[model samples]
Target: MKYNNFRKAVSSLTSQRSDSSLPVVALLTGLAVGAVIGVLFAPERGADIRTKISDKAKDLSDAAKDKLQAVKNKFHSEGHELADLKDEVVDKVKSKARAAEELKDEVIEDAKSKAKDLADDVKAAANEVKNS
Candidate 1:
């Protein structure tokens, strides 16, 4: 149950994060593109340009890691909420199933009682006819 809830929470978070992150992602992409263009056009030595590119790459990587960790923590917290919801649903289903089973048993017993009474009435009528 815990595992299922956690999975569902993670899936839900993934979808939501993707939707909300679109603008951030686009902004980061634009910044990276612009940085690269500026670097290429600058009249710097080849070695200096390479060093700047490496530094930019490391910065982007670190930022991505931070965002990922934050998302992971948020989903982990929400997993408990999902698990509670799942438990409530399972309990309601079990209660309904028990009620249905009880109703079925009552119906069967009532039918049996009625059938026995009917048989007794028929036998009494036949005995009267025999005596007459």
Candidate 2:
């Protein structure tokens, strides 16, 4: 039950993280489109316009690279967090399994002890009947 809840929570967080990145993608797309349109309509000499457009393209490219790096770093961080959570959950499960095994062993031993006691009582009763 606890594990299921943890899984659900992690899934929710992961989904939210993915959803948040969509807006960044859309913003980048819009910026690129706007740059292209602005470059096409500028009233400068052809060579000058080309140079300006090229510079603008380089700037946009750098901005994109920076944003991409940021996203990558965030993804890496989240991945590590997920791995740590996985390890924690695994440890919790292992401990729970170990506890369950110990309880099972105790229960089996208790049952065996009870059975032995019952057998001894029956034997004592049988001896009493024989000696009567």
Candidate 3:
């Protein structure tokens, strides 16, 4: 049987070497050679096979291109959305900054008013003490 012959061949070759990989490599090489021989001996015309392979390869390439374009479009749309979000965030920060500046001015004015009132009260107290 072919299996028995294959096993015998592998055993014979492995007897010559200690490495386990020798048998595996020989098996793979035998399979590759057999496949090449089979494909060469097949009844189909070589030209027809080549044409079919070319057409299928082209179809696969076009499909891949379409997928790539779709991804590009999605990324572009997401980039625009991100830009809009960035602008929104910047506007909000500017508004907050303006509000903080206005609050600072108001606090400074209030502190000045309070200081003037305290000074006036101190002057009035000193005048009263002098009169007494």
Candidates sorted by TM-score, descending order? Answer: 3, 2, 1
Model 1, residue 11: displacement in angstroms? 40
Q: Which candidate do you rate higher for lDDT, 1 or 3?
A: 3
Query: Estimated TM-score per prediction?
Result: 0.51, 0.66, 0.67
Q: Residue 72's C-alpha lDDT in candidate 1? A: 96
Q: Which runs in model 1 stand beyond 4 Å of their true positions? A: 1-63
Tens digits of lDDT, candidate 2, 47-127: 998888689999999999999999999999999999999999999999999999999999999999999999999999999
lDDT, candidate 1, at 69:
96
* For model 2, the run of ten residues with the poorest summed lDDT: 6-15
Quality of model 2 by C-alpha lDDT = 0.87
Q: Which stretches of model 3 miss by more than 4 angstroms?
A: 1-43
> Is candidate 1 or 2 superior in TM-score?
2
Screening candidate 3 with a backbone cut-off below 3 angstroms (N, C-alpha, C), the clashing residue pairs are none
Worst 10 residues of 3 by lDDT: 9-18
